[model samples]
Target: MPRADFPTPVKNLIAELKRLPGVGPRSAERMAVWLLQNKKAEPTALAEALVLAEEKIISCPACGFFATAEVCEICTDPKRDETLLCVVEQATDVLPLERSGAFKGRYHCLGGKLSPLDRVSPEDLLIPQLISRIEAISGEMEIILALGADVEGEATSNYLADLMRGKPVKITRIAQGLPAGGGLEHADELTLIRALQGRRDF
Candidate 1:
């Protein structure tokens, strides 16, 4: 049986939660206590959910988005434009754009931005896959860089634009409607739609 004040597993759970970004030790402890007091069933459900997610979720092969299969539903869909590609930094960023109803094209997840200081290089991202996808899709395709408006995002966008030069395709960037340091995951649908509408040349 576990003690009321501090069980061993409970202490371990609190410590693990504290390791998460933005969660402090006090907060983790409070959460653990709360779970013990009133959320026993909920915590078991949460644990099951996490385990299911870990087992089932995978990176989509085509767009690198989180999905249950190799290729995401969006990539396999025949309705979306095959030529146009909207490049984003992560799969979570795809929701706001999709909810905005402005983008008719498909998406490309870079996985992350270029941060040489953090050892994130061009190869770290899916740049080569992007290039190959562009090559595979013929005709006058457009590549929309929808990365965040930050130093790292700017550097990554510039790098991609330079790489796509002389490829006979148009490369444009998303509009600067989003504030500096803002993330696409937090942006509302209206702002995202306007940003896509007002996108200019790279």
Candidate 2:
């Protein structure tokens, strides 16, 4: 007989839930119980959706975003400014920018930034593909490197800037500084420096 009172299926569900990011064992247990005790239709629907997405979803060939088709919607959108490209660390990053409506340009998800300690290299990301895509697009395009502020992101950005130097395209990095809603008191030295470097005439 099993040591625990809960059924094996419930235990298994909790174990699976624990695998999710930021979900601890206790939280997973609570979620599992909630799923089992509540209206069963929701869990059934969720499971079906997860399975369907897993089976059908694929990485967009051009931009590395998630899509059911070969190309993602943003990549195929004709209205987006082709002369501007915003590069992000992941496909998930693309959605937040899209939600904020801050950028009206095309995007390229690098899949991830460079991390030598993690064994992530330039080849691991979509750099080669990005170059090819740039070549395909006409006009003087500005490649916006919208990577994170961490060490790996910095390394990756520097590598990209060096690679794109003297090329036909204009390579520009996303500015790091005091956020619009943030105060100057909380800003770090690097942030202050970047703010000055990235500053434009008001």
Candidate 3:
């Protein structure tokens, strides 16, 4: 006799869950089973929320953060320092810094770092938008690179510093050697605060 297996719909659900980052096939199967079997699990609500987010959420034009409107709340906030711009690798990186409450400046998400091996070039990022923003500012400005501590992050920072060498802005990078673990998403608020406080010229 043939071994029994999960139903087709359950297998589909597990496959979809496995596509999410950090979720393995076994974990996905467990989650799918739990969602179907658990009394408190609201699969309908979860599906609706996912659809709503996909439909309503968008990347902010001015900054690359998630927004439901034309621009994100941070970019429009008058209290945020206009002269200071923090550049990060991704939209998710912004949250940890914001949670730290150590930075009160504006932000620019690069979308991704420069990785020739990965075929991610400067053109693939928001480098042009960043340049335009810097040029639009009349007075002195400071760009704080809050990228990861990896090799690609280092290369991206160096490339940006060189690109903006003659520009009327001070380019600095967040202090390294801290226990970020992997990226800003994994870093604690205290670590982010310390990194911001200890930033240095690039």
Candidate 4:
């Protein structure tokens, strides 16, 4: 006879959990068991929160950051510097920079980097929106490329820099050789601060 495993419902929960990033089969099984068996684990509350987030959270059209309102808090903040625009790979990248407290400027998330292998092109990202935002700015602005030091990030940065070559904006990239092969999410506050302070012209 075949050995019995988790019930169908429990197995289904584990399978769903496995779909989450960085979660393997064993981790998902453990999480599923904990959620079903642990008294402290409020599965209903968790489900409700997830549903609420999915229903309410939307990407800011202006800067591509997560927001409940039409515009994100950063874009509407009067204290942030309008003259500086930090370009990043994704919405998740914005928080690390914010936590560093080094950049008081606005942000533009590209959504993803250019990768030939991944078939992600400039058109696949928010490049057109980025151009529109740059054109909308009146005075001289500095665009800081805060992308990773990975190959795809480098390609994306170069592409953006070349595209904005004749524009009035000054282009710079965060100091590399530090965050090599890593995204901003992996960086600590001090490292991010140093990178921002040590930015160089692209």
Candidate 5:
């Protein structure tokens, strides 16, 4: 019979890794073993990187997207059109749209959508900031609601539309009947851009 020995520290590391999203127990154990077997300073660097990311990275004040500094790169970019703002649920949702090379407007990341069961309220999102920005815009701007076509997404779009009533801005929602409940992060770049181009008024 062969005896097995497992260190407490290694077990702790594996458990911690398993806590991460999409990382199962087997994958976590493999990662922990890899970290131990690798001679380089990668494990230490990985720990440092995780700590740094959590401590330094913050939500952009204006857009509710991730930003290392006070403002996000897109918000500070002068080339983007201020007269147009595309509203999305998460920060990663912007990538597909950006890759399509179709949109020339700015983005407002809501951080998340309206999910009552998830205890997500409008106050929990960046909706107030969006309204303030709309009010402050010197000229009429077009608000493009780019949320997914899920039930919650539809509710969010309707809420925003009602909020923008009497405002000088034009409100629009991305086209439907494509892929309902599909996240922008998962959508192909061409499809997302086409949706943006074919947006309909809300």
Candidate 6:
């Protein structure tokens, strides 16, 4: 039998690294070796940061974005246009939109998209919370669906539009500058700008 290139600790590190999205076996192994070769404090610092984040950080009660407090900073900001609400899938999607500087509105994270094949339904998302938010505002609010451009996203958008048909709020969807099947994180600033500017009624 061939000798193992890694010891038990290194093998365990590689396994944990591989659990991260988009990291393959080779990449995880390389990361494990690099972490070990570097100063021991580097890995220790990384571990400490992860542990602290997991311990202190939590989903915002109002918007579903990450927050150390009850509500996220964006949701609590009075300057943000309360009449405009942007809806996205994951909490990470909020970062890309904020980075684009194209929107000055608050947000509602859906937790995930509706995919019947994946067995994710409307009830599985934070849709009830979203409805409560709209009802609480109940004053000329507009909902912008900033979701992925995949089939699932389209279906979800259509479903949401139908659901909001009787509501007083205006519903719109982000425009087509985003590439097909791509999420908000994949879009550049200019793309996001155009999409936001060219949004149409749903």
The residue ranges of model 1 lying beyond 4 angstroms of the native Cα positions read 1-5, 39-41, 178-202
lDDT per residue, candidate 5, 32-51, as tens digits?
A: 99999978748988999999
Residues 27-113, candidate 6: write the lDDT tens digits: 998898888896754988899999999998999989999999888899889899999999999999999999989999999999999
Error of 5 at 16 (Å): 1.7
Candidate achieving higher TM-score, 2 or 5: 2
Q: Which candidate achieves the best lDDT against the true structure?
A: 3
lDDT of 4 by residue, 32-144 (tens): 99999999999999999999999999999999999999999999999999889999999999999999999999999999999999999999999999999999989899999
Per-candidate TM vs. native?
0.84, 0.91, 0.88, 0.87, 0.81, 0.85
Please say which candidate is ahead in TM-score: 4 or 6.
4
User: Tens digit of lDDT per residue, candidate 3, span 1-202?
Assistant: 9999999999999999999999999999999999999989999999999999999999999989999999999998999999999999999999999999999999999999999999999999999999999999999999999998778988999999999999999998877546645788877776677678777789
Candidates in order: C-alpha RMSD to true structure: 6.2, 2.0, 5.5, 5.6, 5.8, 5.6
* Candidate 4 residue runs with Cα over 4 Å from true position: 177-202
Better of 2 and 3 by TM-score: 2
User: How does candidate 6 fare on TM-score?
Assistant: 0.85
Please state the error at residue 61 of candidate 2 in Å.
Answer: 0.6
Q: Is candidate 3 or candidate 5 better by TM-score?
A: 3
Question: Considering lDDT, which of the candidate structures 1 and 5 is the better prediction for this target?
Answer: 1
Angstrom error at residue 161, model 1: 0.2
The residue ranges of model 6 lying beyond 4 angstroms of the native Cα positions read 178-202
Q: Which model is ahead, 1 or 4, in terms of lDDT? A: 4
Residue 49, candidate 1: alpha-carbon lDDT: 95
Give, for candidate 6, the lowest lDDT window spanning 10 residues: 32-41
Colliding pairs, model 6: none
